[model samples]
Target: MVSPHVQDELRIFFTSLALGACMRETLAEWRPVVDEAIADLVPREIDTEYLESFFGEPTYAYDPDGLQRALSDPLWDLLDRGGKRWRAVLFLVFVEGFGEDPMAYLPYACIPEILHNGTIIVDDVEDGATKRRGEPALHHIYGRDVALNAGNALYFLPLKILTEDPGNLPAEQRLAAYEMLMDELNRTHLGQGMDICWHNEREVRITPAEYLEMCACKTGCLGRIVARLAAIITDQPERVERAAATYAELTAVAFQIGDDILDVENSLGRAGEFGKEFGNDVREGKKTLLVIHAIEESPPETATRLQEILEAETNTDDELAEALSIIEDAGSIEYAREHALELAADARAAVDELALDAETTDRLYTFTEFVVDRDV
Candidate 1:
């Protein structure tokens, strides 16, 4: 993971290209704000006084150091690992797009970023992944119990900010935000469940539409939360909220498809350039859009062979390499890339339905471009 000092550079620097030079530079500038928000909410160092302030002075004594070790360490370890923190930035972008001064809502911006990292810690364990951000998964370093508890803590820790109205938002707005978070969280788990079930299949049982739907749930839920939270603060009409949420959701789907492309294209290097192992998706037999499309478009024999590698009890490095070749030969990489572009267009169309200002619309367009075009 790059250090916070380097991250002061650009958040999505390694991602695919989009936006003009001016906006691109501005996007980098947006990174540190999200970073600052995350730091503010979940500091690297924790003490009893901090706990008392957050959880109230305990009726019993507070084990500050132990809680810090168990909770703060693992969460920070994962955070110190590289994440674009785009979700938090996305929250701010939408707030600005809806014509709100995003700084006023900065505290709320931390929610999705923290929750996204929480998912990563838990996801690594669920995926049985060995590496994250070029190192061992948190579970490996912290022990399963500690990692699990730490990961779970991230999920609820941000909720306290919401429930306590730390932002001093109205009671009605707080309730709306709370309900939205709960709804999206459920969708995220269901999407993860579908992902697990599909990957575990012995055959290609998932369609492109089905895969897109799963992505809408798994990856898009947090994206939706980012937009929806902004909508709440902006007090946008339902139509505007729906349009903004759709843009976020579809952009997330496009981003996931792009990442799946990298699973085959860039999987050969970078130890999961996108925070996973080399060919990690193949190793997991992840039925990514690449594999799904290859199976459908290739010759029957070729299709059968690809499935054989995926369904194998365990794949060798050679076999995974072969799988990449098979998908490439089927031209599934370009096919998937084209599909991602379509999703980005769909996302833009969602924004077009809104009457937002040109700058806001352009920024949304720029974000969609980044999602489909990113290299990792």
Candidate 2:
């Protein structure tokens, strides 16, 4: 069960989104207003004509049926599914921290969310995931071929927006931002590749340090990009921007570890609420911090058994339950929870290094706690 304080924090976050103070809602109730605003930035029609007319036809003829709908519809469907909007919110919060109007960066704020959701669509297909956010995976509904094309299209959408002058940012700064985005994308893919490779290999043992590094690249890259973008828009000093980016990276590590712990606890019934099966990480043989710690700390025989279960092609319900028992018996769950708190504290410390107002610093600290403590 969620504590009252955590519940209140979630309430405020969602309330902010609903009031259009943080996010542009795409729900049916707010669709008209939100769609109008988004249309100004992302057009309804995403046709090859724009590409051909703007950049000339490619060397090879390229076409897809219902190109516009194929590209935009799936994106809208996923976005409208609802999320915490954490990255976008963090971008705005940092903008406000720098004494600028948060609303001014709204269009650019959509960049993180678009990139994140696009990645999720692809991740689901790659991981053979059955559900996402309590609904069937995008590929499950739209089919893999169409979903892959749509996901790829969404990845480039942000770049197209950056090339434009929506933020009215200087050309040099825009170029710098584009470079930063590319850098983070490369890091994210590298981290994902490592994870995919590890899962496919047999009898592999990953150290806790390696697992943390992977999380930094896979998850931290998202946070770093938004924090860096905030610094860019605010025109802060390089040192201050680096500090903020570091804080964001630490926060991402805590967030991912917290998620790992939740997968084991399964206390919130995430399978229903988050569209992730209970213990899916174990089933996929994910090298989460908890799994690493449990294996390293367990008896030699027990460790071998744990690894064997993880490497199995499939496990019965009883086998999965026993694995959970082993992890708990090894006390890895509590260890992970305590470690997440430590990471969150470190993230808060990094925030203090930023030269923001007292109130913004306090809010950022609170947000770091929220990142780790959230139930969903």
Q: Which candidate leads in lDDT?
A: 1
Query: Per-residue lDDT of 1-376 in model 1, one digit per residue for the tens?
Result: 2356544443343222224444445555566666766766777788887888888889989998888889888987777676777787778667777877666677788899889889998998887778999999999998989998888899999888887675578888888888989999999999999998887778888898899889999999999999998998678888888888999999999999999987788765443245445676777788989889999998999899999998898887778877888898889989998888888888999999987877768778887886678764
Quote the lDDT for 136 in model 2: 93
**Residues 277-349, model 2: lDDT tens digits:** 5677778777788888989999999988889989998976666777888898999999999988988888988
Candidate 2: where are CA atoms >4 Å away? 1-37, 44-65, 267-277
Q: Model 1 TM-score?
A: 0.88
CA lDDT for candidate 2: 0.76
Q: Candidate 1 — which residues are off by over 4 angstroms?
A: 1-19, 22-30, 267-279, 316-318
- In model 1, the Cα lDDT at residue 49 comes to 74
TM-score of 2: 0.84
